[model samples]
Target: MSYCGHPGLMPIEQALNAILTEVQPVTKIIEVALIHCLGKVVAQDIVSFVDVPPADNSAMDGYCLAIADLEKTVDGVLPVSQRIPAGAVPEPLTSGTAARIFTGAEIPEGADVVVMQENCSEHDGKVLLPPVLALRDNIRDQGQDILKGSVVVSKGQRLRPQELGLLASVGVGSVPVYKPLKVALLSTGDELIEPGEPARPSTIFNSNRYTLRGLLQALHFEIVDLGVVADTFEATEKALIKASNADCIISSGGVSVGEEDHVKVAIEKLGRLNLWKLAIKPGKPFAFGDVKGTPFLALPGNPVAAFATFLLLCRPYLLTKQGVGNITTPTFTLPANFSRKKAGMRQEYLRANAEVVDGKMMVNTYPNQSSGVLSSTCWGNGLVVAPIGQTIEHGQEVIFMSYSDLLY
Candidate 1:
């Protein structure tokens, strides 16, 4: 009948899976300029129309010549028949002659090999190439990077700057991408005040607003920010209705079983909510539900708890809803320098920094693991995942996920 250290807590993985399973990917698509497509999901597979280079190009500033000619020459001396700068079309090579070529210059029609300028000697407009270099020594073959009709970008793949550049290189001017998700972001608590306001009473500036904003921005969401709502049922219900227009509504407080917490009561009147107590440290209370058909996720009030849960749980669900299939965060094992002699009932994600000790990465937790201590995350670079029912010792290898890895 009440919520305090919920007995039926969900395992971290199971909770994430359950949340992601019910969400459907948005199918809407929009065409954006090449430059603006960064951080967007590709709506369709993009097959390149032509080879990346479009032709055989030299990979060095050197001489291009037929390989057969070099084998026949006793003195290895060849006349420079043509000069081919980049963007210049070349005539067929004359017999016993080489074309002077710069890097990125198209190889002559008859040339089968390129000798870098350093390897060949030039005197009186003639180059003497040694026979030590192999055939086709420095030629970038046609279709080497991207062949015509090859898929350059696949459906549901997020476009990074390099991906956008690749699309541009393949002559794609505009890209079809999933429309940016409009997420209604809300923060609550009467003790919270937005930054830039002079504090009149006992209050803390709402850092979660900036925290969630940065997190969503990195994942390329268009946020509809609804600043801190009051701790009343009427206010909470009104805020939910206002946020219902967006595809998803996310709030950072008022889901716990406090007398003042109205998020659960408000959602019950409008829709259904599944308040999950996750078996994870720093973050435990997470609510997933819907209001007026839009998805809703209510996180804990603690800034660090909100951040951890968003990265480890909410982020995957949102990404899946956006059609991204690879929702798992990258993790690696590292030696832990700290120890926990007592086993924990739940998995603990310690805010710890890693350093190289004796050629091995060693992790050390921050001084404080308090959910409200934002400084712990500030000083640490990654999360050392100490599994449930397991005790860790010094020099033991543990699973770790860096903040840089999770955020991007």
Candidate 2:
């Protein structure tokens, strides 16, 4: 079917905005240990109770001395009054003496500067110093890294490794984070069979189930697997009813306009379904609505189409609903090494490999761009986005998005 000049078809951006406007972020919050909060969104701003490196300390293993004492000596030397190792406190510096200090040791009171041990030598209970010394040299000031009562992490920010380390440094033992979203996953097709089951005539093993599961898992959502529902009105309606318990509902297949496709009708019966004909390749028939107040997303039946649509459409919606501050996927433009003779009516996401040829980075697509061919997706590390009604030539700039950025 030609989607060109179709009045009912929605542009990709319009459809995404419509979906996002209808959904609200989950408000439930839970306290999680700092170590277990990776990939989880923060429910509240985390403020530091104490400054990092609470006290002034040494930046190196050196000697602490008063400047006045060095000036009194004939040479750059002073008597060693005490030894202060890391984690040990020292008495106040004597009027005319130096203290042997190690890295991370707290600065002794009345000491003006720390001279590196390498720049000084010890002989017969006294230490030699450089003639010219800078004040506060090799000394880390208190609150150098973080100040008390400052927000270490803001609300809606997803916790990453570096964020976790920063929180740990400020002695944050636990944090309040949004609860992981629960998603109901369903698949519909009469001719579908699960893997490990005996193969039957005219039956294809179900791959959408596994594909959707992996995508949901990568987002850290709790999946309520509804398995494969038979291609019947009763079965589809029953599945939709059960799925309404989750925060969101996602189904593959049975969304297209075909006699065997019953998901659209079933969803309408339970609540409402806004079936959209999107101007996008691989995935065209997409459904977004709510099932008994729970948001619903229905993807195309084709395996490759399901994968592409999930990344392009469903991913951002899910992230926004989970309270993520930044839901946009990162993309960059690269020169195309290959060419297409004819322009397509719908926006195309071609499975492509990007490499550095000579000194410039170029992208090349898989030989076959068929939606049913799942192997094409496995062969490429990223997708080259071709705009609607646009043709490509060699060395032309094209937008590229990586799976590494999309999967999470």
TM-score per prediction, in order, is 0.97, 0.91
Task: Judge candidate 2 against the unseen true structure and give its global Cα lDDT, from 0 to 1.
Answer: 0.91
Clashing residue pairs in candidate 2 are none
In candidate 1, how many Å is residue 119 off? 1.4
Worst 10 residues of 2 by lDDT: 1-10
Q: Which sections of candidate 2 miss by over 4 Å?
A: 1-4, 66-74, 115-125
- Clashes (backbone N, CA, C under 3 Å), per candidate, total 0, 0
Q: Give one digit per residue, the lDDT tens place, for model 2 in 1-408.
A: 334576677778888998999879999999999889888999989999998788888898889987877888898889999999988878988889999999999888989899998999999999989998888989999899999999999999988899999999999999999999999999999899999999999999999999999999988899999999999999999999999999999999988889999988888889997655798988998999888999999999999999999999999999999999988789999999899878888889999999999899999999899999999989988999998888999999999999999998
Clashing pairs for model 1 are: none
Candidate 1 error regions (>4 Å): 1-6
Find the 10 residues in a row with the least total lDDT in model 1: 1-10
TM-score computed on alpha carbons, candidate 1: 0.97
Candidate with the greatest TM-score versus the true structure = 1
Model number with the top lDDT: 2
